[model samples]
Target: MPVWQTIYSELSQYNFSVFSIMEDKNIEDARPWIEKSGAKFPCTIDTNHIISDLYNMFNVPTVVWIDENGKIVRPNDVVVMNEGGAKLVKVDPETYIEKIRRWVINNDPPMNSNDDFIKYKQQREHTDNEQVARAEFLIGQWLYNNGELELATQHFETATELSPADVMIQRGTMSMRGMDPMKDYGPIAGNIIKKGLRLYRPIRD
Candidate 1:
């Protein structure tokens, strides 16, 4: 809902309104932050998570910009950060602000969807493994927050099983493996083997 938040933040000049938050699922937990962030805007809760999941938001802070008929002009990653446009490569706060201004005013996206980005988006939809990875990460986050370091490792291990290549899962796994240099490289060999098998084995196999 960053788009809506931005729009509402400038409603006096732009006359835009935030229609909904559309958060369904375990997001009921984030209500305090939502209220604090959206003190002036209208917000509602969704228990089913239908819209968020349909758009493949495995986590918080996802959004879509829909036209009147509900066509998506922009899908995922549409919300530009209000961080005052920093330079993408070497962005200062002023540069970030300028970027944010450009994003809010421009009708077209700064860049077209490239082949790699399209493939990444497709990866989110095409792989059940990714969803499973999300579940693992969520569980791991819960475990970590609850002071269950040993228990959290199990969830992270499940995430690695789900999406061995998922960066978030990899990062979490790395954090848990901190200071253990030998363990650090263990997954790399397994990853190489997995990649090799995928390359050499027939698709049917």
Candidate 2:
């Protein structure tokens, strides 16, 4: 987040700003990082993973580049924020930053052509099961919030089954199931990998 703050600070003069969302079950879990980052740009907590559902985002640090006119220049893609994060996610943070810099400074779209963008969006469009998973997740979240843990867990489990690759649905419900997400992420990630699925799929340049 500090890295994001730096990027925002450097690019704001060019009319580039960031609206970061942290996908945590509660604000208190996200508040420390938010306060520590001291980010001037808008930072909010997605306690119910609303942004994830809206953008078809499955992973953390997913970026959706939008222009001044609010058009999506780039859809949801993994953007590891820092060097340590790059190592964990196995992506070059510098490359992601360079893309952002080029886009912000030169007004370049990340894709080479509209055809490419359209094809990419079509390929990554939200599936019917994913839509249903979002609804299930919402019901689960409400149940969990209202002290119906067992019933909530059932819905969460159903949601994960519906969207097996959606980390926001899988890992996001860990705390409700009495698991530490950070500590238990390895098994979940391993499962995704064993199934020949990628957790981080970035837009090609």
lDDT of each model, Cα atoms only?
0.50, 0.86
Estimate, for each residue in 78-159, the C-alpha lDDT of model 1 and write its tens digit.
Answer: 2224453222212243443344345446543422454544554565563677677667766776776677878878887887
Q: Candidate 2, clashing residue pairs?
A: none
Worst 10 residues of 1 by lDDT: 196-205
Candidate 2, run of 10 with poorest lDDT: 79-88
Highest-lDDT candidate: 2
RMSD of every prediction: 9.6, 1.4
lDDT (tens digit, per residue) of candidate 2 on 92-165: 87887887898899977776799988888888888999999999999999999999999999999999888888
Candidate 1 matches the true fold with a TM-score of 0.44
Deviating ranges (above 4 Å) for candidate 2:
none
lDDT of 2: 0.86
